[model samples]
Target: MALHFRTLLAAAFLLVPATFAVAQDNEPDVDCDNAMTQMDMNICAHRDYETADTELNAVYKKAMDAAREMDVQAKDMGEHYVGAVNALKRAQRAWIGYRDGQCELAGFAARGGSMEPMLVSGCLADLTRKRTAELKTVYESEN
Candidate 1:
């Protein structure tokens, strides 16, 4: 009886590690991929937004340069033209207003909850990425 009990105890100890390994394997990935808590989700969402915003800024600079070039060409042509730079500035301002308002509306889907921030930030990131692509299309089309 004592030998049988000892055998069972040793088997149980060995199986415990295997069980834990399987459980861990089934778990979510690290960092944002494993963001199970609301706080972590919010943080990941904000980080995503920040990355998108940075990309947008870079593309916006290139777009602004392109617009300025267009303005110069129009001026050299001696034709009255709506300034490309000015128009781009106006459009960007309007887009910013729209993005903010639209994100706020998205947050209302989770209103007053911990997930509100995540929803808003996710929306912001998505919109910013789309806007970045649009800017690239407009300014870097030749490339």
Candidate 2:
């Protein structure tokens, strides 16, 4: 059981980069209208992306830790299983792509509108919540 958990945890960690890459790639290019204000806009945009990325990274780390705990438990149970690790990795990658696309689409509702930032932020929050639920389900099932 423990070994199984470790395998799952390792898999989850390995999968995080792909998700992060997708999220980063799909991030909208923030425009700066004036050279004088370019630094400020860049800073604000960077801060926003960093905040969102940090939250998402935290979720991934938590999932990985849970997987590790599950692995330890499985090893203790003497099951000696090694199933679904690759599947989990693939699923995680798919999920990242899904999240990026979904969030980008969500942002379109307020394109060129004053609420664009709000729309995008809301979309990100929604995705984070959904992803959290998915991870919870995976962790619960392992138990």
Candidate 3:
């Protein structure tokens, strides 16, 4: 039993990075290949890239609003408020890249599937939900 557990853990450890690498290898190419027409393809690619951009912007705005609220709670909290807001902004930007990359990867999965648009949309929704949770954490921590 002990050996079986150890083997399983080792296998999981090794598989994690390999899975990540395979996912990374698949994302951009999948998005690139899914376009049925040149225009539609370009649009699909743009939409995939923009998903993160839009989510990041929304997170930034939410963070800023939270910071402002915090500022109103205590005047001397400016520096801390600003710092949290800035951190959230930076995180948001990074999240945008993460979201886009993940979505691109998901797009690859959709390539051979019949419901590509639905798959892509689901990916975007999941990413958005994640970003919202991140923003909420930042907001709650500052308060």
For each candidate, the alpha-carbon lDDT, in order, equals 0.90, 0.66, 0.68
Best by TM-score: 1
- If scored against the real structure, what TM-score would every candidate get? 0.76, 0.48, 0.46
lDDT of 3: 0.68
Q: How many residue pairs clash in each candidate?
A: 0, 9, 1
Tell me the TM-score of model 2.
0.48
Question: How close to the true structure is residue 74 of candidate 3, measured as C-alpha lDDT?
Answer: 54
List the candidate numbers ranked by lDDT, top first.
1, 3, 2
lDDT, candidate 1, equals 0.90
At residue 84, what lDDT does model 1 achieve? Answer: 84
Q: After superposition, how far is residue 137 of candidate 1 from its true place, in Å?
A: 1.7
Residues 1-143, model 2: lDDT tens digits: 99999999999999999999999787655553432443444445445555766776776666777666666666756756533344466778998898778877876887776556555665666676667667667656756
**How does residue 1 of candidate 1 score in lDDT?**
100
TM-score of model 3 vs. true structure = 0.46
